[model samples]
Target: MYSTQGIEAIATVTELRSKTSALIDQAKTIKTGIMIQKNNEPEAVLLSYDLYLKLYKQLEKSSK
Candidate 1:
């Protein structure tokens, strides 16, 4: 997720299945990625599309 520290929020795989909309909103509102856990271990990150695009642009520039 942006290669940054600090998680705006966290949710388990089950929670993600049930509260996907809410979790997505939280990510958007906080403008930071949400750490998703599976088996109590961090497995993925959820980020708002805008934030993803911004980070992607930064990565592209740095790679040039």
Candidate 2:
């Protein structure tokens, strides 16, 4: 999972499983990714498609 200071939203695995649609909607509305935690540790991140593409492009450019 991507790590950065000041991440304001988080969800546990169980929460994500039960409220996938709602959490996704919230992420889109907030325009920020949600960090998913498992076993009380960060496991993955859920980012909107646009944001993922943007970050991917940035990484690609930086690696060039």
Candidate 3:
């Protein structure tokens, strides 16, 4: 399971639809991820591509 320790914001599915751009900007500005929720449950994370690549690289390094 992913940790929620430092998550700075959250968006519901409906809000995601209406505020996609703002949410994405928030994620980028934070240099972290924004949790996406559905039915009051966490369902996904919105993170910048740069951050995604960074995490992917870390995963590759740790798996080796």
Candidate 4:
């Protein structure tokens, strides 16, 4: 599933590249959340399914 306001927090292109391994490592530690950006525009989200499904259910209800 795709998200519009996907991943509130973000990591820049450089941060993502230089810290790719670190990012994944962090992901394993905590429920990681990220919005990959290029030139300050949202490109995509990187988040765990646990958090995703939780928020997805919330959005689904709010739309009603």
Candidate 5:
């Protein structure tokens, strides 16, 4: 199961540009996800690539 807590570090599209690096740093430090917002509404998510790849591999193995 996944938790929304990992994906709630939101930043608007405009602010994203400036905060992107910091966001990445945060994700790296926390080993979690972040939510991106557009117009004050949730739009997308940012996840730790390492975690995503790990989960992906698990799913791939399970699907086999």
Candidate 6:
């Protein structure tokens, strides 16, 4: 099952623009992902490199 607990933070586009570096560092440290919002809607996701690769591998395996 997918869990929402992985989302450690949420940021608006403007906020993310200004704190991009810090937020990315925070995500890495926390080992969690960030949800990016635009116009109060979830438009994107920023995931840690390890988590992203893990998910990618899982998808690839499932597709095979």
Question: Model 5: runs farther than 4 Å from truth?
Answer: 1-8
| Cα lDDT over the full model 3 | 0.88
CA RMSD of all predictions: 3.7, 2.9, 2.5, 6.0, 3.8, 3.6
Candidate 3: worst-modelled 10 consecutive residues by lDDT? 1-10
TM-score of candidate 5 to 2 decimals: 0.69
Error of 2 at 32 (Å): 3.2
In candidate 1, stretches whose alpha carbon ends up further than 4 angstroms from where it belongs are: 1-4
Candidate 2 residue-wise lDDT, 3-55, digit = tens: 64555699999999999999888777656688899998888888888888988
Residue 47 displacement in candidate 5 (angstroms): 1.7
Q: Write the per-residue lDDT of candidate 6 for residues 1-64, one digit (tens) a residue.
A: 3445567788889989999998888778666688888888777888879888988999999999
**Cα misplacement distance, residue 52 of candidate 4 (Å):** 6.8
TM for every model, in the order presented, reads 0.88, 0.85, 0.88, 0.52, 0.69, 0.82
Off by over 4 Å in 6: 1-6
| Selected candidate, larger lDDT, 5 vs 6 | 6
Clashes of each: 0, 0, 0, 0, 0, 0
Candidate 4: TM-score?
Answer: 0.52
lDDT of 1 by residue, 1-63 (tens): 243378868889999999999998888887779999888788899999999999999999999
Assess the local accuracy of residue 4 in candidate 2 as a C-alpha lDDT between 0 and 100.
Answer: 49
Model 3 TM-score (2 dp): 0.88
lDDT of model 3, residue 60: 100
Best prediction by lDDT: 3
Better of 1 and 4 by lDDT: 1
